[model samples]
Target: MIGLTTYLERAQTGVWDLPAAFLPHAYFDAVVRAGGIAVLLPPQAVDDRVADRVLDTLDGLIVTGGKDVDPARYGAPAHPETDEPRRDRDAWEDALLRRAIDRELPFLGICRGAQVLNVALGGSLHQHLPELVGDRRYQLGGGAYSSAAVAVTPDTLLADVLEATPSLDVPVYHHQAIDRVADGLVVTATTADGVIEAVELPTVPFGIAVQWHPEVDSNDLRLFAALVDEAARYSAEHTARHSSRTRHPEPAR
Candidate 1:
């Protein structure tokens, strides 16, 4: 089954509430549209051992969009524009993502989730795009989504899945962007102002992160479909591995 990690939104009391965990419809819609069963993973149960256990059972990982990541994660000073930081959630997801990477599990990160993936992999963020990029129309009107056009790199995984030229209009609602890209990751897409829009780890099985919210775009089914197909393949492989070990026990290793 495909498992997607859900981030916890902090309340005023600074307590991580499990019941408060929720994800946008676009996330579920994308997963469902891709023919994968969407399983919501709790942020509270995301320690290293637990993450490893979860990864052992799952086929793919989807890190959904949420609030800004704590700057301390990427070795940066806190930006004044930063909002309520979910430290616990950060720790949990980081461990989960690390385990996923070690297992080479297919991962799809969106918006803040993309930032988290970058930071987890030794990268930094801009914190506030307006201050860093200057007069950019990142946050769309009505606090909804980004209407910016992202230029996709040719000969990239995302480009292959999208099947579009180089550029495509995407929805953006983030004020932060990837500054220093993570090691083993390549910039696959960007905005006109040079904002990092998408990143892909070429060596990995299927690791991709996008600064935009493709979930919010109903027309963007190809992206999610690709992820789901990968997940299905992973599931088949995992099941076969387990069955082989069970049926033909290795001779007294």
Candidate 2:
């Protein structure tokens, strides 16, 4: 099963208007299309123990796109363009990510999810990309996606998964980018402007994240398919190990 993080935001539906734990259908849709079961992980009070409990239930984890991560996480003051702190979500995702990393869980990050991975691993964010890039090319506003030509690094997991030529035009809609990349992450993709577009944890079986919204591009399921394939392998190994333990319990003193 693929555990996908979600946005805990206020919503309005028939005869009701209240805070809800929901996610865009597009994310789960992509997971299902890639041949995996989708499980929603809404923001909640979390500790390492709680996070591990959640992770123990799934074979893969996905940190989906959403509001900007709080700058305070990386010892930086908030930028004028930064969104107000989503403390609950931030804490929840951080704990889960750290635990996921420890367990080497197969995972993927999208947009803000990528930023979280960086910060959780002693990295920082640019806060306002337009301010640094001198234009809003990454974010065109009005909930519309702008395209970016990202060059994928050769001989990297990202390149292997994408099987891309040299570069790919991807849908992007973010105002921030990785500033000081985390120590253990390998930069796997970048744009013409030198913006970090993707990173992967080389130590893990399958840990990759992209600044672009892969879910938005319905035609390209390469990334999702790669994740699902790894998740299936992980699940199979995990199940076999558990069965072996169950079938042959250690002798009691």
Candidate 3:
């Protein structure tokens, strides 16, 4: 099963209700298209042990996009541009992500989720892309979906899995982007204005984060398919490991 972590959005009165929230259709479509069972992970009963067990049982993780992350996470002062923070969801997902990484689990981060991943790994973000990148047009008219061309790196895993040309026009909807990429992560794609559009940690088996919402784009099925494929691989390996352990009891010490 692919465990997709849902972001916690703050409600009135400083409360968070993850279970009551619904994920975007595009996110569900992408997971289904990838041929994996998508499970929405709420901020429910999450602790160190629970996180470890969840990571142990899941095949892959998908961090879905939502509101802007709290600036305090990356050691930056609050910016006026920063929107309402989702502290509950942020803390839950961050813990889950850290556990997933420790177990070397494959992960895919979308939009705000990508920012969380980058920040979790000691990376920083342009709190506001337009102000930082000096591109006032970066927001794409505040639309839900905007078309932007991303130049994919040929030698990266994304380029190989995508199996497409060096550059392709992808849909983008993001106000912030990765400024200083995380350690050991390489920028795999970027926009025409030189905004970091995608990133991948080469050392990890399968870690990719894209600024664009591939889930929303019908043409971007390949991205989800790749993630599902990885999930399946992880599942098969986990099953085999468990089976082996069951069949072959440990020898007497």
Candidate 4:
């Protein structure tokens, strides 16, 4: 099963307005198309034990994009443009991700998910891309996506999945970028302007994240497919390990 993080936001339908835990269907749709079961993981009361129990039920995890990760997470003052803090969601995802890494759960992160992974590992963000890049190219207003070409570093998981293409034009819509990369993470892709576009935890079986929104493109299932492939392997190995433990139980003193 592939567990996906979701947005906890207020919404309106018909004559009612209320808070909801939801995610764009595109994310789960992509997972299903890639031959995996999709599970929604909404923000909630969480601790290490709660997060571990959740991870125990899934073979893979996907940190979907939404809301700015409160800057207080990285010990920096919030920029005027930063979205108001979602303390619940931030704390929930942070707990889940830290434990997920410890368990080496096959995982993927998109857009804001990328930032969460970075900050979860002692990294910081630029906060406002327009200030650093002198333009709003990465985030066109009104829910529109802008395309930016990024160069992929050869010999990385992203390169292998993308077939070692020297560069690719990807759909992007974010105002923050990774500034100080965390330890145990490797830069895998970047735009010409040197903005971090992708990163991967080399120590894990599958821990890759892209600043671009691959889910935005209906035709591109390469990334999702790669994640599902790894998840399948992880599932098989997990089952075998469980079976072995069952067949040969350790003696109790």
The TM-score leader among the candidates is: 4
Summarize candidate 3's per-residue lDDT along 139-189 as a digit string, tens digits. 675565767888998888989878956998887777888888888889999
Clashing pairs in 2: none
Off by over 4 Å in 1: 10-19
Candidate 3 Cα outliers beyond 4 Å, as residue runs: 10-19, 133-136, 141-143
lDDT of each: 0.84, 0.94, 0.81, 0.94
Candidate 3 lDDT at 245 equals 97
Q: List, residue by residue over 1-253, the lDDT tens digit for candidate 1.
A: 6677775664343565444677767788778887888889867855678888878877888888887899998887898988678887788788878888888899898888789888998999998999867765897547666588889999999888888568989888888899999888899999878999999888878989899888888876877888888888888888899899999998895
Model 4's TM-score against the true structure: 0.99
> Worst 10-residue stretch by lDDT in candidate 4?
92-101
Q: Flag the better candidate by lDDT, 3 or 4.
A: 4
lDDT string, candidate 4, 9-106, tens digits: 99888998999999999999999999999999999999999999999999999998999999999999999999999999989888888898898889
Q: Residue 50 in model 3: shift from native, Å?
A: 1.8
Point out where model 4 deviates above 4 Å: none
Angstrom error of the Cα, residue 17, model 3: value is 12
Count of clashes, each model: 1, 0, 0, 0
> Alpha-carbon error at 97 in model 1, in Å?
1.1
CA RMSD per model (angstroms) = 3.0, 0.9, 3.2, 0.7
Candidate 3, pairs of clashing residues: none
**RMSD to native, candidate 3:** 3.2
Model 2 ranges with Cα > 4 A deviation = none
